[model samples]
Target: MFEQLGLIGCGLMGGSFALALKRAGLVKRVVGYSKSPSTTERARQMGVIDVEAPSALLAVSGADIVLLAVPVAATEATLKAIRHLVSKDMLIMDVGSTKRDVIDAGRRVLRDHVGSFVPCHPIAGKEVSGVENADVDLYVGKQVIVTPIDRTQPEQLQRAVDVWQKLQCNVVQMAPEAHDAAFAAVSHLPHLIAFALVNGIASQTRAEDFLTLAGPGFRDFTRIAASEPKMWRDILLANRQELLEQSQVFQRTLKAMEAMIEAGNADALEGFITQASQLRANWRMGPKKG
Candidate 1:
């Protein structure tokens, strides 16, 4: 699909992209760069990329497609470092969880090149990090949300969609603001609650003992708490307004449940439980393989 592909930050996301493209024969060459020497070396040893660049600029140079797989906080800095080197023909895209900030940063640094940059968020990941955990099929059948601004070129948007389709992803397009707001409720707010639940429990007496008795439900609910803190922190801050609103809604729901339990309102509690159960059941019916 492309002559050469560049990946900036070869951690889980970038490394996985490289693996996917090569596995699908979508690219002839993949050049990757990461700040950590060990990560770059690991990616090289794993055959995730044909070449490893020493800097972000070198990695993106002469490439038809470039992916910024760094944290939301580092997106702007990475874009600035490679803005001048990025060829006009290159299709630049970011896999950051948040979109508005990254899209704005692209507009500022990339200027007219903004049309080439597509802000995308792949709603798929593992708790594990590094090149070792990278899988070629990581994005297969996953939903990839592409946020294109008014400045985005039609051809560039089509190219971005085509690339994700090649990776076997279900591609969907949305406005950057809408993407942020929706994800704030579904993704960011859930992560926050998981972290808070784990921390709150840890503060209680016999916390370690309580953990030993916890079941699959507790384990599943708090699994996201194990994700990289710095990355999640950046995502939360970047989408703070949407996240805060979601958090408030969550807080209200929690308070209502607590009040129902305290007042021994069986009917109200049952109604809440039924609604939650139905929502979860419906979610399970979405795009899952047997």
Candidate 2:
């Protein structure tokens, strides 16, 4: 636990951490700084942050812990702004959806302090966003991946894990590259598919009619499509390389399914559908690759 937590970006992800720390009695004070003044003020009014600093440097002035929860594209700039204030002994972590790019950003901006920056991605969020929507328990029972590089300090890595564990998260360790590849499949690909599916439907002449007749399946599949657009945009582009690979993999499967359907090969089509059904039905919720 730290005496003060310096939070950069007082949005849903960042505000939720401040709320979680306060709820768990972990940190004594949380000083937040967001690029938007109104956002910082909103976080203060929502009781998510104890203090709102005018600048990122002032936010971490004397803090022992710092967390960056900004957009993935903004990681380097945020780190650069506070690099001078980051101390060697301080514990630093990020709640990015992508790890490799974030690690690269740390390398670019943090330089000497890079070892203290333990790159992490908390696999939890809501379709809605903003500091007002931050939930103290958003991270509870959710997966938090810590991807440490060769340059990462052992002590800093352990401390980062401890912090997530304190918040009731299922902490898992993975290599940064593996983390990017896995999430590109499970997380990023799905979001891209959702956005595509929703937009595709809307492009048709009977778009409104199609949507009106849509039911639970459509709703369930496109639930994430309702999420913050800018956030997903950043995520999709940040992990573009891995996502492109995943897309190619998915394309192969889609073509195979289409081939079976077009050829009226009912048995093969059923077998294909059943294979996916069996996998999903048998898969149990447990700590994955921790």
Candidate 3:
């Protein structure tokens, strides 16, 4: 077990990591810090953290493992804050949604200690935020993507992977840029589309009237729109380049459907809808039998 875990950002992601570590008995104690005092206090009360640190540096002090679970935009400043406390033997990782920007921040702030940094993104979370909603099983069975940089220490990278493995996470490795690009399509773009669709309807003068008659499909599609706004805003902007590309691809599909509906082309519309339905149905069915 790691002697101590230094967790920065005591929000949902960070809080959940600490709980997972504790539940797995992989970490002896957790020292946590958040810019918001209330969050740190809440985390301590919730037992997500064993110690509440007043500053980021203090949080990492005497800790062998450090996790920065702050937003992608705050990576630079947060890393700069705790860089001095980082050591060669320490394992530093982040649960940021976008990796390239975070890896860039690590390069800028981590400097000599960059080898200890392993950029990670756990493909798990809910529509809610904060320590109050943190789940101990958040990472269990989730895809924990580790994007290692050239300067990453091989042993340290494996140690980071092991930590997640012990938590029952399915660890995967990829380049930082590729992680950013892939997640932008699957995770980031969906959130953006959800927000856009919800807002588009809400922007109409009769939005409230329409929403009152909305059903399960609308509720399921727009559930993500209720997610923390500032977090999604940061995610979209950080991965804007990749997200823009994904958005264009989605727009093309949308245009094709739009044209089919406009022309009342029954055969073409059926084909268009059928393809998507078949793909989604197959995915729901999981792997094919041998």
Candidate 4:
């Protein structure tokens, strides 16, 4: 069990993580900090954190494990804030959706202490955000992608895996670049499409009329469009190159289907639909448990 968990960013992701660790008896105390004083205060009042730190560095003052749940854009500044207190034995991890940029920030800010930092991306969260929406079951049975660089310490990596496993999370390791590329296609691109789809429809003349006719399929497909704008904005920009590459592939496939429909080629359309149906039917999410 960790003596103390220094949680930076007391929002949905960090609050939920602190709650999870507390529930699993993995950490004895949680010291949380947020950019907003009100957020840190609320997290403390809600029992998500045992103490509210005035600054990021103080949050990690005596902690053995630290979690940076801030946006990918703020990673470098956050690392710089707490770098002095970060030690070789400490296991520092981030829940940034994109790993390549986060790893780059760690290298630049943490320097020789970078080995203590383990880049992590937990494939879990809701469209809703904030400390009030934090749930202890957030990480339960979820797939957490840990992207470790060459400088990462083996002991620190094991500690990170152990912490997640204790929280009932399925731990998977990958190179930072590979993790970004894979998630761009699976996670990032989908959110981008969802955001764009909603905006595209809203910009049309009959936007209200179109929404009134939306069915369950449309609701489900556009669900991610409700995600926090600032968080998604950072994610989209951070993984833009990979996301754009995935978007191009998606556009080509869409154009192919459009061409078939325009030509009245039912056979080709059915073939394309069948391929996608099979692919989706074979996919499964990580097991979830209470």
Candidate 5:
């Protein structure tokens, strides 16, 4: 059990972490801070946090475990604010979708104290965001990737894994680079495609008319298009290189299928479709090393 959990951000991810920790009886107190005062106040009013900290530094004043649930872009500033109090004894983690940029920020801001910071990406969340939508079960049974850098303290890393495991999360650990590359292929690129797909259709003159006829397949495929714009924008930019590489691979495959269609080669097109269908049908979700 932790004496205090200093939660920064106080949005859906942060608030949900606090609620989950409280419900699991792992944290005795939660001190939360957000860039928006109203958000911090709302989190406190909703019982997501025991105290509303006025600043990021104050949030970690006496916290043994700290969670930075802010956007990837704000990581450096957040770490700079709280670096004065960061110590090897504290187990600090972030829930950013991208890891390399966050690790770099921790290294730069925390310096020698970087060992206390463990980069984490929880494969969980809803399309909608904010403190109001925070749910206690957000992390339950979710695959949380803990990406620890070379400078990370072993004891603190173990503590992070333990905390997530206690919260009923299937925790997996990987190096920061590997984590970024793998997620770029599986998560980031998919969101990018969904966003582009929606925008491409909406750009047409019959955008509204086309949407009116969209069925479950279109809705399901473009579900991630409704994700928080700012958050996804930061994620895509942060992991742009790897995401671009994945995009190129996807384009190549798409072009191959398009070529078959253009040539009117039914046999080749059918074979290609059958192969893709079989591959997707045989795919099983689970944690595997990068």
Candidate 6:
């Protein structure tokens, strides 16, 4: 879709995008920058990007499209660091999980140039990270959420959609608030529960023995607990209010289940299990990629 593309991060998601674009011949050249010099060198060695730039601004300079693939906390600072160097003709977009903060940050720095900026979130990732873990088809047929405010231009929105579509993503639109609320329920809450469960188990007696005897169900349920702690911490803090509400709802349900077990209410527990099983089954059967 563009002659030259700029990526500001070379981690899993960023590297994956670079690989996908190259495989699809969507861009003639891909330039990248990362805070860690070693990561930039590694990304180049992995052939994820055609070249590595010395600085974020230099990397994005003269590029037709610039993608901010850094963490949510770094979005505003990255935008400001490259504000003076970014051209008005360049289309800027961020793959941040939360949208409102990023959209507001763009408004502050982009101003009239905001027309070229789009807020987006790709709902695809792996527990592993870095260039080595990046896959060229990571986003193929995966749902990508594009959250645009009233100030977003139609052309810019379409450009963002086209880029993602070229990567073989299934595009979906949502308001920033709604996106945060929904993800809080599905994504954030599950991570929190997984973290809590693992920690809770570890704090008890015979923890090592318990883990040694754990089966596939336990391993699968707690796999997300292995994710980077810092990233999940930032995500939780960014979506605190929504996450808190979801936590309360989850706690109530857990309490109800506990009460049923305590009273030996077999029918009530059976009903709860049936309802939850059906919901999970529906999710598993739902249309989704990989």
Cα-based lDDT for every prediction: 0.91, 0.92, 0.91, 0.94, 0.93, 0.87
- What TM-score against the true fold does each predicted structure earn? 0.96, 0.98, 0.96, 0.97, 0.97, 0.95
In candidate 3, what are the lDDT values of residues 220-252, reduced to their tens digit? Answer: 988888999888889999999999999999999
Cα lDDT of model 4 by residue, 252-285, tens digit: 9899999999999999999989999998898777
RMSD of each: 1.9, 1.3, 1.7, 2.1, 1.6, 2.0
Please say which candidate is ahead in TM-score: 1 or 2: 2
Candidate 1's displacement at residue 253, Å, is: 1.4
Error of 4 at 22 (Å): 1.0
Specify the poorest-scoring 10-residue window by lDDT in model 6. 281-290
What is candidate 6's lDDT per residue for 143-182, written digit by digit as tens? 8999988878888889889989898888889899999999
Stretches > 4 Å off in candidate 3: 284-290
Per-residue alpha-carbon lDDT of candidate 2 for residues 143-254, written as tens digits (9 for 90 to 100): 8999998888899999999989999998989999999999999989999999999999999999999999999999999998998988889999999999999999999999
RMSD of 6: 2.0
lDDT of 1 by residue, 181-249 (tens): 999998999999899999999999999999999999998999999999889999999999999999999
Clashing pairs for model 6 are none
**Candidate 5, residue 184: how far the Cα is off, in Å:** 1.4
Error at 281, model 1, angstroms: 1.7
Better of 3 and 5 by lDDT: 5
Cα lDDT for residue 12, candidate 1: 91
